[model samples]
Target: MSMDPVETFRIEAAELLEQVEQGLLDLTHRLTDKDLVDAVFRGLHTLKGSGAMFGFDDLAAFTHHCETAFDRVRKGEVPATVELVSAVLSARDHMRSLVEDEVTQTHRDAGAGLLADLRRAVESAQGKSSAPAPVDPAPVAATQDAPAPAAQAGWKLWFSLPANAMTNGSNPLALLAELGELGEMHVEADTSSVPPLDGLKPADLYVAWTVTLRTDQPRSAIDDVFIFVMDDMQLRIESLSAETEPRAPAEEIVAEAPSIAASADAPAAPSSIAPRAAAEPVAGSGDAKHGKSSESVRVPAERLDELMDRVGELVIAQSRLSQLASASTDLQLRSVSEEIERLSGELRDTMMVLRMVPVATLFGRFRRLVHDLARETGKAIELVTEGESTEVDKTVIERLADPLVHLVRNSIDHGLELPADREAAGKPRTGQIRLSARQAGGEVIINITDDGRGIDRERVRAKAVASGLLEADQQVGDHELLQFIFHPGFSTAQKVTNLSGRGVGMDVVKRTIESLRGTIDLTSTPGKGSEISLRIPLTVAIIDGLLVRVGDGRYVIPLAAVEECLELSLEDDLRSRGRSFISLRDKLVPFLRLRELFRTGTKPDPHQKIVVISTGSERVGLVVDQIIGDHQTVIKSMSKLHAAVNTFSGATILGDGTVALILDVGHLVAAGQQQEAQLRAAG
Candidate 1:
């Protein structure tokens, strides 16, 4: 999709933020880096201009104050200092909040404090610099015929208003007047479009004008003059090859075009641009120069979701066609089906790209988190991030934020050691926390590792046993004991401060990850700190499924979880209802009977099949009447109406218009665990 002006601003704003943050950090190290100072000033200048144009007035106003202060520094009048950089850093965050306002996200407490600090800096700097020169007004010239466009000295613009210009409330006079604000300019009115009195529509535009403006602004500045009427009025603004105007304060110039908009920052012209009967043309200030135009259109996020839903439907329809083709003997129909399948696959890939976003958006948050934690805990800590460009589904990114925050906080509060204690142990005073992301197989792996004193296995084991999460007499490996920390209400910290230790956050992290159908692995060494890695699927929207016919109903087992399919004789199937076990590769694996579990009453086919699936370490085979081959399944959430039903994650439709339920592997795994627990208790 082509980016509109708003999107353009967003892209530019994002880069500006990166520059501002990096500049702030570098300034923290070298306060006198002139390049960094200029870089920051440029970023602020662009942000202020773009924000104001896009209707972010509050942001523009706040940033304008900041930009003015930075501009002073760029001019070498203000010295770079820690307090100055720190103030700007804080202002950068406030600017972010303002930009989010463009997207209408919630962030409050606008930059009042930042503004005060900026003004203080500006006033202080001014005290150390030469007095600023005053701005000169436009000098009415009598060289209208003596000048030769100043020999490429400035811009000469020629623009015409539509026929009904004056009657339509566009005071062409004011537009010309605003033109003069840039510099000395001469205007000639054309009334050719204005018909005779008998043929005129009083309200219709019927006038045009040609003006030579001498200003430093690019052609874009001239376009701003008629921006409000650009699309409707056949307005064409071009550079004048040459201009010879009498530089005189002529009353005739205003008399000829006594009906248009007022000049920006200049005296009101005889002709009002607003065409409001020679009255005030400006309701607000003319400082905006020209009206802002956006390159991108603002589309609500919900509309994109709707588009994705339609695309999902199209994919499912294509899946059905593919199914029908593989079964049919007609060559032509089969060929068409194959083509449709290929096209649909390509389309789906494109849609996937639209939904994918880099994990860097998530990683950017930790800078602030780590910075705050360092200040709070008074520990020397550094945060390092890697693989920021690794892409993940948007939903996954949203869900990953909370858990990541908790992990980083825990590392700062409990995992890292105090600087003095570290020096005593001959370790560097600064603790390092590394957050990295990488794509491994079908999952994205995010690891948050700290180089502080690692998790004390002994303390964890003691906490697990004492908290009743583990039995005292139970003989458990350190790995198993460490896992218990993910159990709710289980923490090993000796005491509870604001940081973590009170045994609460980790369990939520575990639960949230599991809810996303993800896994977390924890590893740590006594003196090497801890690393918690999260492995989550790239997307949860669609998957290949092994469809099976159970009795008369159809079911789909996720192909990711299914190992292989098996055929069974009637005798073997009938005899295994009470206890189903399959011999695969010389190993016996337990299985579930779909007929009995789904409570299907009809008789199974004489020849049946078993679909073997596994979740984590447990493997289970499902007995069905027949295998329905592989099908592309679009996951449709079991509506809030059916959300409580645990056996199935969602439902899908087949080629012949049959509905099949997609099994929830996580649920099945839990069910298997429950059965095992019961059996062991009985024994």
Candidate 2:
């Protein structure tokens, strides 16, 4: 099927914009880095040229203006001053809206304002570069265009695009046409590699090209033509000068006639010289070959999700087969079932890896966020990211974006103190916000930490009392007090602000995380800054869980959270009847009797097992009837009737066609903690 050129351009343009943004952000720290400056300019140049080619005239025009501003920086006529960087950043965003057909009056006005600022910055820098004594431009031009130098400057380019390049949306003809625009050029095709008519692939490009060009444009220009096709394509470019070795008769004849003007309209030019032996293709901006792309194929995200769904079904079917096989006396059937089970397990693991993406894609956007936030708050804030390569489920990453934004914004606005305040407190004038992620067991833990004034406990307590969330003399631990921040319409800010502290964001963040079957915890030291950590499961679709029976009901506890299981002797159970706590290695670990918690009046088994599970540092034991071995739990959402149950996060279908509830470790752990607090208060 023929791909749409406009859609192809949009995808390519989006990637170029990302490069442009990254380059501009990098330049903010190292303004004098010529490579960074050139990188940014080249990205803008390609986007403009490609945009115009694909019929996005407005985008092409807008990007050209920004490209011109960066061109000045590239030529050393203007420094990449802070003002210029900021202006161009804004322009870059406007260019995106234009490309996406999302431009509005506001965008137009913002673009105008940014362009105005950019012009002023460029003019200011130009005044400095041009301040030196003016030299005669006529002599400089004559020196630049001297015949000897011009003759030595031209390049011969040979390009053989990938066979499927056209199918992948590359236009070789358009590329050759662009080369014609570069300078005086002759182009010819080499058809030696083309197969016979019976064997030809309609979508494949079988011919190669050789071009002799005379231009002052750098080799980078030639490199840009094959930017989108650089992967696995053969391209060679060599300097052409008087001293260069003369070509053979056939090669000379092939390279001589059909100047770019002569073959401009020819669809089938004659064969040219063979490609210069093994000259590696020079890639354009951000086209560095990391070897991964050569073996990769692009698949739509929905297709991946669909594949996961099918895999989940296969796992369920395999489970049913295993259950039936174990009951039958057929030896061959049992062996086949075990083999199928093994294969299904392997497939599940492979699917998990496919769904996992590096957290770096999530972290990259925060550079711009921090840049803008620093300016908005009038305080120097540096964002440091760690463990960006840690992989997590793509769904988890997408859902985490908004909550992380709220937390990071809160850290800057309410957690981090101003420069003067921080300095007065004997801290660095520039506050630091660090975002770090790592996979622990089956969960990905993400922490947003800021080194500034931490949460004010006394003030929070006072506000809690005033707001009637607590009694005036209510006593609570620091950790319990922190939970009040997640309460709906809760805030202790002295005054409301536009960005936050209007009693809005934090509760929503908590709700969103909980909906994803995750937990968030906040820790703060009065003067040592604050950190909020979110622990989320790696994937929600299927999980390895330990199935256990509590009374007559079955429950699935995430195996990732299980520490160990210990048999609770009747003597110890009877001795600790009222006070449900056990001493494990001299540590008093709390336990909850599931039969009592669930009010399942049925008598428990003589020998009760305590399943010790943990979330982070808190450990709690659940007393259950029996341990039913591990099962692959495909989670299904609870209906509206059971949505309010805090003890279970979701339900899963067992192999026996019975429904089992998945335990919510966060809720259970919190309950255990509260029970311990109550016992202490009574004592």
TM-scores of the candidates in the order shown: 0.66, 0.85
Which candidate number has the best TM-score?
2
Per-residue alpha-carbon lDDT of model 1 for 1-683, expressed as tens digits? 65566666776687888777877776766876878876787677667756766677887778877777775565555666656776777788888877765433333344776778866765664565465522211111212322333443455443455444443335666667757877778777655445689987665554455566666554434544554445334232333332233233332222122123333223223222323221223212111212322334446556666767887798878877877888989999999998888898888788777778899999987886776677778898888999999998887898889999999999888789999988987789999999999996556889999988888877887887787776778766666677788888887777888887787889899878866666677889888789888877777776678888888888888777777778888899767644556678997677667787789998878887877776545677777888978888777777898868878978888777778998876667556545544454555
lDDT per model, in order? 0.69, 0.79
lDDT of 1 at 576: 60
Writing each residue's lDDT as its tens digit, candidate 2 over 13-125 gives 88899999989999999998988987898888778777877787777777878888886676555667887888889888888888887667776777777778878877776
Clashing pairs in 2: 185-260
Angstrom error of the Cα, residue 504, model 2: value is 1.5
Clash number for every model?
Answer: 57, 1
Worst 10 residues of 1 by lDDT: 133-142
The lDDT of model 1 is 0.69
